[model samples]
Target: MNPFDRRPTYFFGVYHWRERLRRIGASLSLFGAAVVVGRRGGRLRRLLAALVGVTALVRAGTTARRLLSPVPWALDRPKYDALASLLPLGDVDRALDVGCGSGRSLVGLAPHLPSSTHVVGLDVFDDRVILGNGPQLARRNGARAGIDVSPAAGDASRLPFSDDAFDVVTACRVAHDVPETRRDALFDELRRVCAEDGTVGLLELPITPEGVSDHEAYWRRCLGDAGLSVERVATVERPGFSDEPYVAIAATPTA
Candidate 1:
């Protein structure tokens, strides 16, 4: 793929630079160990060296495959698509995507929205967490995706928009990233900017530690805490592309 192919690049801190370096270091160490053991000149040592060398190769290959795969970002297309479908975009005049990294979520939603809709994206654009993340990248990606997006820099906990400013609000895989201390502020902001009767869609990894009941309860509590009523919670699965299951939570500001 072209380095600058106008596609949204949202590799957000999953494999941190430190983590990558550590993996590389381990692989190199294993290779060194194999070399050292192979020179012992014994049948058992030779067998051990072969196994160790193979293990090192497998580890290296696994890391390389993960780096090459379009995971943790590009693979979320199906989730975004499901979210766009669940939202009330038919009559929406404006939409706001909170934490819109590189505008990939917007690209998924743009196709479902009216051409006249004004789509705005807001994010802090911390390049440390997400490589090459910024308003410029979002604009370029939006342009390439054939959608006009207004990308802005701002904090999610304290959005730079007035109350009831947007007809639809969306936060894709963003709620979990907020600091625990600011979770209330972040959700409140999401609800505050949304117009009356407007929808706030959240595509999140399910809290499925215990079971399905607990999972649903977790979301209900989350939305309730934010003063939003849960409208629907549905699963969206994309076989072969994504291994993790995602849930689309649709909510509206409570009366």
Candidate 2:
């Protein structure tokens, strides 16, 4: 049976269901507004309205897709291993997962880290945040090892942590999903949460070529400019998309 079928978890489940439904309603309202705007507007206004309509459609579709799919859009399928491979330190004091969908990667790698380490998973999706069993599983397994998984909702671009709070901060398959305009800010937030000498593992889809060369070059340039030293990079063949490979970059924020 579903764990959320119980009392505490059920409360959060109700909240999530309501939130998801509200978002769907809001997205539909936005689409209707765009259509109405287009009917009464000039060419330029119609163009702008069309853009808004498209954006709303995409947003609504993305939401519905996640609701229907087993895995969320951000970390669907073999992407689970994508983040797990990024941890070089193998569990330190505390680790944070940004855009952590369903916390599958956290639970998978929890045992790899020391029992004393704390693993926190963050995601903005209401459903995933409510239902992610990865954190609970990790908590259960790590009880003997003294590890705990705390899941929370957070924005990728605006982290609520002080500078250098986490020993390790990981953003798995998240950069591309974010708007390019906000990617820099999101990146900065990742750096902010990371301990000064700590590490940030970014596992992203390679927009460049498939090999490690392109992967290394892209992250090297972007992360280097952001004051991160590229410690290591490896080419990984993600299971579902074997033809479309991925790269895992491990970097440290400079002083």
Candidate 3:
């Protein structure tokens, strides 16, 4: 069996359904306008209506297709598996995944750890983007995968764990979501919870010019300011998304 062939069973979160419905509604509205305008409008008006309707229909179809297949989200199994591989799982007794959405990264990392290793996942599960009981789904998915993962609702900037509580800490595509005012706090929490020599793995998409200006430089500064030494940085690209690439950074505490 292929290691990355597994399909994600819990992809239809609240946000997913919401987006699907929004698209479908927009498509229907556009089609209705096209029908009404075509009945009594001029040639130019009919052409414009048809174009708008067709465009909306296409967008609706595309959104539906994205939800159906795990391509952009769950299908990137290799990336999660790779991030997990970067950790020292055998030596890690306690692992923490910050912003662990649906336990995808945890499920990928758990198989590599020792049976005695305790894995915990933390997320606010605020449903700001993807709606659903994130923590609940994560727990269910972890159990089905035969991995013992404890999922809980919590803030990333203010971690509940004590200092030096975890041997391994990972945050995938979470840094960008943190507000600028609390970004430093989030990194500090990561450093506080990580052991003296523990590893910190981060996987994030390149900061777009419309977003953060410079992706690499921004992360380097963010990590460096947090007193973490970036040991390595690698890029992962998935075609059809964008020309820009995704970046994964591995760092260790300097203090």
Candidate 4:
């Protein structure tokens, strides 16, 4: 069996269904307008219409591909598996997943740890961020992944947990969601809740090709400022998605 093949039983819902619908709608509108214009236009005008039509078709194709792909969301199996394998989870007694939307990343990491480890997920449960996102959905997904997840409601910048509480803390593609002004606070909070010798794993997706290096550097700096020493940073490719690179970092709180 292919290691990357998705397990038949493990499932995570498609992320942001509404956004996919909106893209499809916009593409159809553009295609329709181009068709109407091309039917009664001069040569130059017809050429412009053809360009628009091609653009619409391309946009629609991209959106359709994403809609059908279960990646960067439904575990993006390889990326999550890499994250799980890279993190030091051997002796972790308690773990926390910040911004655990639908518990996807949490579930991904759970199977890699000992069954005795206590895992908790924290999220704002805002549907605006992900359709059908909430504690109920998270618990259900966790069940599908064969892990019993405990859900909590809270903000990343101000975690509800006390300092040095968790042995392993993780956040996947979460830090980029916080406003730039408050991101420092979020990092600080992540570091605070982590035990002095505990490991913190962060997985992030870079928006642009040009920004990948800068993005990695920025996150490294953020961890440093938060008093965490960087231990490892690995670049993993999301083959199931667009072949984009995912940045995974492992750090430990400084003495």
Candidate 5:
């Protein structure tokens, strides 16, 4: 999705500007200082550079900070990345990536969706979704990738799709933002739109205490409440990234 003034907060805490700003400012400052000191090149410059050594030391510090920074640069996470690896890409039909940001996941993983599959990215932030180019590019990129991606504005607590309208439904780190009472409704909506054998993937970054609860058991309880059964639950921890543990929750309709 596109950017917005009143963007609904992301549960993953990716939008926290304070930490992000610190990292960005540090990196840029280091870069700028290095450029300033590196301009005067000479043998004596080397001696002066040795005295200050602003560029190398500062650049190294920034690089290390970026790797360790718990910043969510794109709202993209392992859940989407892992699911993309597992998806039966060909012609994905009505494949929805809930909370799709700027279409990063869609662009990377959509190629694998079936030719018949239409990738729909839904987000509460209409501005980001519009700027995301998800819906527009679905058609533009669909012909080449054999998969279509559409963008829409919808509430995760209650999606607008009809019963059995989708073959694969994916929600990423979105549940953490919804009230506990409302999650069941969201799961139900996800179930209602899924085909009989369709997959419902809940991708989450555990931030809150509830989000960090036993991943498998949580999916069972949540998906089970929606009359869906957990088919697979994979918990993955990516090193040098992701402060929260992630899960790829694959479920299927029980009824």
Candidate 6:
């Protein structure tokens, strides 16, 4: 694969240098305030300042790392690869990626499916959260990967597709972001669009401290409430970011 070919101009190819610099400056100011509080304030004030300082430092460090190296950004490839492998794609004819940012997951899963398979990615692009033109960037990324993907602007909670429209449906790191009250609606939409025998693959960050405990029950309940049955669950460990573990859940519509 040509590193320069088909790459999205805004997604990974362009760095948000100005935004990162602003964050760095803010973090430095917070650190300076922490030092002043520690020297002249009460014990409680010092403790609060210390907490804020630590958070600021961590944010600055992560932002700096992202700016200095491409490895952190490239990690999405392996993450999507793992997600695609966990889903049943051998005989898939039509697939959809909900909340597909820059079409990375769709492109990554394309190679695993039959050449004739049709893949579509839907996302409600918010300029504040999503960098650049999402649908266009997704198309460019798909072209670079030699996959033909249809990218569209849509919401997960209210998918525009008719019932039983896709053979495989997947979402990466999107469910938890939905408000607690609306999460069920999102899964309900996923179940509605998925064919009876089709699989719904969800990749999410661990919600529990140990990374595997009660989270299983929580997801099972969520899927069940949405009229889906959990088939399998697996935890994927990201190479560079060990503290953040990804959980992939495969579910099927209930009878």
Ranking by TM-score: 3, 1, 4, 6, 5, 2
Per-residue lDDT over 11-102 for candidate 6, one digit per residue giving the tens place of the 0 to 100 score: 43324656777888898888888888877889998898889889889988988876645432353566677767778888889999998776
lDDT per residue as tens, model 5, 1-255? 555545322222234344545665676665556556657677776566554555545665665555433443333445556766544445455688776644545554654665556678786754331333334543343334344557787888778788888888887767877787787888888888888878888776654444455655666688898998877777677565545467677788896
Best by lDDT: 4
Residue-wise lDDT of candidate 2 within 130-246, one digit each (tens)?
A: 444343433443343344777666788998778888998888767777776787788788888899879988877776433545654776677777778888776678667776677
Highest TM-score model number: 3
For candidate 1, the clash count comes to 0
Tens-digit per-residue lDDT, 105-163, candidate 3: 77766667887878899998766556554788778767655667888678999999999
lDDT of model 4 at position 18:
79
Clashing pairs in 2: none
Off by over 4 Å in 4: 1-8, 30-58, 69-73, 207-212, 240-244
lDDT of 3 at 114: 82
Deviating ranges (above 4 Å) for candidate 5: 1-81, 85-91, 126-147, 208-212, 241-244
Q: Judged by lDDT relative to the true structure, which candidate is superior, 5 or 6? A: 6
**Which 10-residue span in candidate 5 carries the lowest summed lDDT?**
7-16
Task: State the lDDT of candidate 1 residue by residue for 112-204, as single tens digits.
Answer: 888788889998987665556788877766665666889989999999999999999999878778876887898899999999889999887
Sequence-dependent TM-score of model 3: 0.82
For each candidate, the alpha-carbon lDDT, in order, equals 0.78, 0.68, 0.77, 0.83, 0.63, 0.77
Cα lDDT over the full model 1: 0.78
What TM-score does candidate 1 get on C-alpha atoms? 0.81
Question: In model 4, which range of ten residues has the least summed lDDT?
Answer: 6-15
Cα lDDT of candidate 5 equals 0.63
Which portions of model 1 miss their true places by more than 4 Å? Answer: 1-18, 71-76, 208-213, 238-244
Ranking by lDDT: 4, 1, 6, 3, 2, 5
Indicate the TM-score of model 6. 0.74
In terms of lDDT, model 4 sits at: 0.83
